[model samples]
Target: MAETVTPAVGDTPAPASTRRERTGWYVYDWANSAFQTTVITVFLGPFLTTVAELAAGCELGADSCAGYVYPLGIKVAAGSYYPYLISLSVFLTVFVLPVIGAVADRTTHKKRLLGAAAFTGAGATIAMAFVTGDRYLLGGALFLVANISFGAAIVVYNSFLPQLGGPDERDGISSRGWALGYLGGGLLLALNLAAITMLSEDDNPQRTLDLARWSIVSAGVWWAAFTLVPLRWLREHPTAAALAGGGGNVLTDGFRQLGRTLREIKAYPLTLFFLLAFLVYNDGIQTVITLASQYGTKELRLEQGNLIITILLVQFLAFGGALSLGALARRIGAWKTVLLSLVLWTAVIVAAFRLPAEAPLPFMALGAAIGLVLGGSQALSRSLFSQLIPTGKEGEYYGFYEISDKGTSWLGPLAFGLVFQLTNSYRVGLVSLLIFFVVGFLLLLAVPIRRAVVAAGNTPPRVL
Candidate 1:
């Protein structure tokens, strides 16, 4: 509810005020990724499935657990627990996050809002430790809160991009943040993997489950602790006084601004086209990240320790990949670099279908392939989009960007779940992602970055 200080037009600085503040902004990426890497990408899916099975009074080895009634008396199959929950959370968030983003744009203490959302999400994550056997409802409710907060916080975080740098610096800056994110997430994942391996007893599922629960709790702690740096250092830029025609009510002004912005967005056709392309491919990428460990656990019958290690490998390798792709973008351009990454993503999906169940070597190779492209594709996409946003509207525009990112996310997971339910095959479910990648690649090829920049009344990148 904080209002921004108004500054005269054309008075904003070229970049962040100091190296310290810039580092603080980057550290936020390091802070929040613990939840993304550990909870969303690796552990939570398998853990929630176990909880669902227990709730249904079924043993771990069963093909299907019947009579697992979710909250509100809805019956859910055990196999669909994680995917359906993710889909449900995304569906709910897509409706409200844009409004949250608009409000953040009007606030002077944007960093405070970001910190509040981060800690609130982290609290939900820490509470996951209490979700014991037959407590699936508790786990699902907590996950919904965490995911919603995560999405809202990201809207505020991304709005800081224009303040950090101009178009030329965006790729390196964005990629550096992503690399730091990998470092932070990877470091904690390694520690948790070591602890879980040491604590897990042979032939004891309960002990392994307990260790996994503690790992989730630790990620929450890491998120809250590291976020303090950004909260203390990142200064808020002045906002327009007549934001949405200068109404007294901030929320009313925010919605009015959002509507005007949506109407104006049509003038920049390439921006809309690029967003469509991003919407498609990002769906595939998000689906792969969220479902990878679940596939390893359920389809490949891999041990929990190995799946954790595989993703640990992914995190570090993705660190290098993010930096490497950023450097590559300097030579070729961010758009070209991202398009190339999409090619690799397409290959990764096709190869996924051919991977034999229980083969460590092939699985590890797939993990390596995924690690190589994962960070690069996402980092470049963000940088490229930052180049197209109009001046002084970062928060409102980023809300639309996030909507494209998370709103379409439900389609990929829903498709994966439905395919698995119908065919009883994870491979078939995975194949559905290929459609997203291929279509996205084709759409991206048509975007004119220079034209898009000019259309948005922004400077075009030198390379483009």
Candidate 2:
């Protein structure tokens, strides 16, 4: 396996031509976020749960199916299946993302890997139209493939950030990407929501199913169509002749390098500390993203229309929030800004726990608060870690970063699920998230950013 390397951070001037090329790279986020918004976050979760119940041959209202009682002894419906499917998807991504990221870096074919993943995801999304009663397994399978591709493509996309921006420019560029993503995602989701409302009737199950399928296909088509912008604009880095001299395979090298990096972490204490902080806090972030809708539906008893509207508000607010945060970071520094966001997150989670079931306004207020911090925290964290990576191993180190982002995500969700399962209350689950925020905030405070960047630059190279 090839070892992960960071690009040099000196004031090496990027060519004017290269700067021109970077514009198109931002468009990829615009293109791909449609899938994230429509398929993963808003539309699909509810649709899948609805479909799963239909597949299980359970009536709209039933006490049990397949001998399993509903946790709350409420009606056993298709909605019950969605959480399990999402859990399975999360589990698969944890194991697959690191390997996929490593392979893309070692091969110096990040673009190709990204393209392949995108196409696979798109195909699976399109195939969702075939899902029907007794086809829950098929729907689950497609979701698995689509989500894995989404995660893998993200690794490749993030790797391009270093090529586009230096330490001075990275925060702005990262913020721009995230903001653009929110705009693109929100626009498409709004269109899909409109289509569903206009084309489907309340009592027409087949028509509703068709509308759902079209929404899924729209995400795939949107992703594939928009990807061309980045495909045409970005350039891959030149591989070193000496490093390429042997019959060394990039895939084999990637794994070897990953192992070596794991062992070398003790020498980079600050980097280690940042990674731990990221792991903990990001777990909370991922849990919120995954479970927010479920919480609205199950605990708050929100109507579908209200839930969709709240999500749409989140998308637009996230755009403004991310850009404003970039400006704020410039004034006070990224680390402090992130700590403040974590504090806000803790407060919001506590508020969510206290929100009454009938209070839709407070729930929307909660969504607005989430929008303000979500984009800034994630975008700045990516840029911050980009500064810490050693030159030449961007892919390898990011592989580990992806592991932190995706791998440890299970902790938050698992804890949330367990708490909900035991207490039959999401309030307990929401309160437990405070622990992750507090721990991650303390760990992040311990990292010395200046020393870590210098040490990462000075570290000696090694063959994986």
Candidate 3:
């Protein structure tokens, strides 16, 4: 397993899109990341949680104020409401993105779908400005629309990878996309923090809440405005199926195509196994990210200032880290680079489990390390997946890929919660994440990547 999977390298190169078009692709990442960083990461959950708590008739910081809020007449702990919304959004995307992907592959309308989904999400996100006191239902419904549209847009976005660059170029391009995304997200977040700080005065509680609401609006505007860059640059390259002229209704045919692909997919075991490994490990990665602030605050009692700085550090460092890892992948193959990253991921978990209270410096160092590996592993995974998708089926496969790629899968957090409940130790629960990396590593190690490329009717890249 230690030996690299290097196949014969005499095949003709894959046709890559022009450099300008590739830049357009990168800008889309830059655009959407505003939503990820601003709404999803910084403001929405906390704001909405506070709202839910109000609905439950409890002050947020009150001791012994464990209470429930009902959304759509269903009982939910106020604290758990955000997680439920996230789980619901992710679950819906499992059905939505795949069908969207299947449709994109069969039509000449990929670019339209991308713009439509992006704008639809941005519109819904903009409407989040209206989600104030006792509007938890409005917030939840808007998020479901925003998040599912986000994933649908991403499926179409990811399918462009194979066409945007040759296998040799994908690692670099994907890295740049993630790097730019981090930069974009970080910049907007900094401005947002500044606006929130300047406008929020002591004793003006209403003003403070208003600032948060407006920041949500700014993120939506940013997302919608930046999306034009990609839509302007990307010309649709119709799929073979598109040119073949089936004349069938796209929605109906898309699902039919989806059903067919499911039945036919088993023959590509290498790709299936890779996806399984991805689902497991990526879930761990996302769960760790989602829970870190809670762990730092509840377990370590770190100040809010410390957490903010640590998060911003990861954002900037991940930009450079993604590019560096892509360069490394060029030299030592993407597959092995990812395996190395998993080892680093495991080390981060070990350090986290042993972290002591009130140690901001150590915690910041951990953030730096997580930053170094986060974008690299994720960007490479997307590029590597491009190699294993059967030609003419890129959209559908990447749809499946999106389910595992983003903020969707919630099972890892579910497991993490269960472990914490059983042991009553955050450290023990954190360490339990090791199982995902370990299983993913073993599964990835067993994959014959070069053989998988050939099996997918692809010419193996020079490195892998």
Candidate 4:
């Protein structure tokens, strides 16, 4: 059932006096990011590969035995299909998030929707424990559900930003949320890693497998536990009376509203341009996050412990970097800060391609550089987009924002996978990402920010 919120009558807005409540709301990121760090980005890929090989009836250390297997049904080169699976997941999210976002906007059930999505995601993540052997299908299925829920929940969460703050407070609030998320995510990831180390052996195959499963489960539990903060702290705004005119058919009306939004894009050119730029650059960023672990393990051949440590470093670094970039963005414009991030990303990708296999230190250095730029780029991008959205239509526009964020993500991974398949080289695949960075940077440079913000129905402030 949908939960209802009653907005306070007055000039100040619902979130104005609720500083402690807003802080609690921001903590949800910290609660949820553990899944991204430990399960999705770092540990899960390698762990799944190991599980697949075992399920294929292969013994450890046997020369002829399979060491890795694809979760997809493809028997010929399973590793190549992993990227495609990622693309497929993103494809599903692209179709689903906008509608969900629209529904939240028109309905009075934003918190209910968010809670449902969080539980769904967290449940799927926790269910990863039972996935073993040929159960790679089970793992993938759970991952698909969790990933979709996570993305959808984010839509609801982001929609709250406009409701929570006036224009003057939005960037700081958004940046603080990101920073807290990094800290929470990093802290939980550390605990999970410690549990794995204490409970399992480096060479004991069975125990190590158990440890991996535990790590995934911990992320789920952490996510569920931390989400309570936001669930309690954030309040949904009242649904408009106009949206209630359809009686019991409000959901249908919500869909109609979304269709209307799509038709109205011609009225907002800057929003259109920003969406395009966001789609392209965000794809590049996603590719980097998804592929870096595989690149470390398969291509660089770094030790597992070192790889884990590097990822941990990234979480902490990203926390610091996000705060730093927020400050930097205040000094130089947000657009320039974003441009700087793109330049750094291009250099990092190019450097990754050029790195020698024997020198793992360079790879670690590259990871740190990525950590510095990654959070800043994404956090600032979200804030920039927030500045462009209409006052009351944040949810509807952010629905489209999800489309831009996740829709063509397939392009980056598909490009990387295809390049790797054709050339049989990770270097070539790494180099290909440079194209996304360059193209996105060029396109972004051409966007007239002030005009775009105004066109999206935001009042044009003098400096921005």
Query: Using TM-score as the measure, which candidate wins?
Result: 1
lDDT of 3 by residue, 1-464 (tens): 12211222457455546767888889999999888777776567556666777789986444223568877788777656776777777788888888999999988888999999999999999999888877788988998998889889999999988887666777888999999998998788788777766676766645655676787788889999999999998768878987774788877888988999999999899998888888888877876776676577656767545665777788899999999999999999999999999999999999998888999999999999999999999999999999999988999998988886666666766665556545655677788788988888888888999999889988788896
Global CA lDDT computed for model 3 = 0.81
For every candidate in turn, the CA RMSD to the true structure comes to 4.0, 5.7, 4.5, 4.3
Ranking by lDDT: 1, 3, 4, 2
Query: lDDT of model 3 at residue 430?
Result: 81
TM-scores of all models? Answer: 0.93, 0.87, 0.92, 0.90
How do the residues 1-464 of candidate 4 rate in per-residue lDDT, one tens digit apiece? 32222332234343443676577668878877877777777777767655555666667423223234544445523345556666777889777887887787777767888899989999999999889655767877887888788888888888888776655455566777888887877887788777766776766767766777888899999999989888887766744633455555656876887888788768888777877888888888888787777778767777566677778888889988998888887777678889899999998888888888756788788889988998888888887888788665677777767653522266787888788777767778888888889999998888899888767656543244
> Candidate 3: minimum summed lDDT over ten consecutive residues — where?
1-10
Supply the global lDDT for candidate 2. 0.72
Residues 206-257, candidate 1: write the lDDT tens digits. 8878888899999999999999999987888746643434447766867877
Query: What is the lDDT for 85 in model 2?
Result: 54
Model 1 lowest lDDT segment of ten: 2-11
Off by over 4 Å in 1: 1-13, 61-68, 241-247, 404-408
Give the distance in Å from residue 167's predicted Cα in candidate 3 to where it truly belongs. Answer: 1.5
Give the Cα error of residue 132 in candidate 1, in Å: 1.1
lDDT score, candidate 1: 0.83
| lDDT value, residue 362 of candidate 4 | 85
The positional error of residue 79 in candidate 3, measured at the CA in angstroms, is 1.8
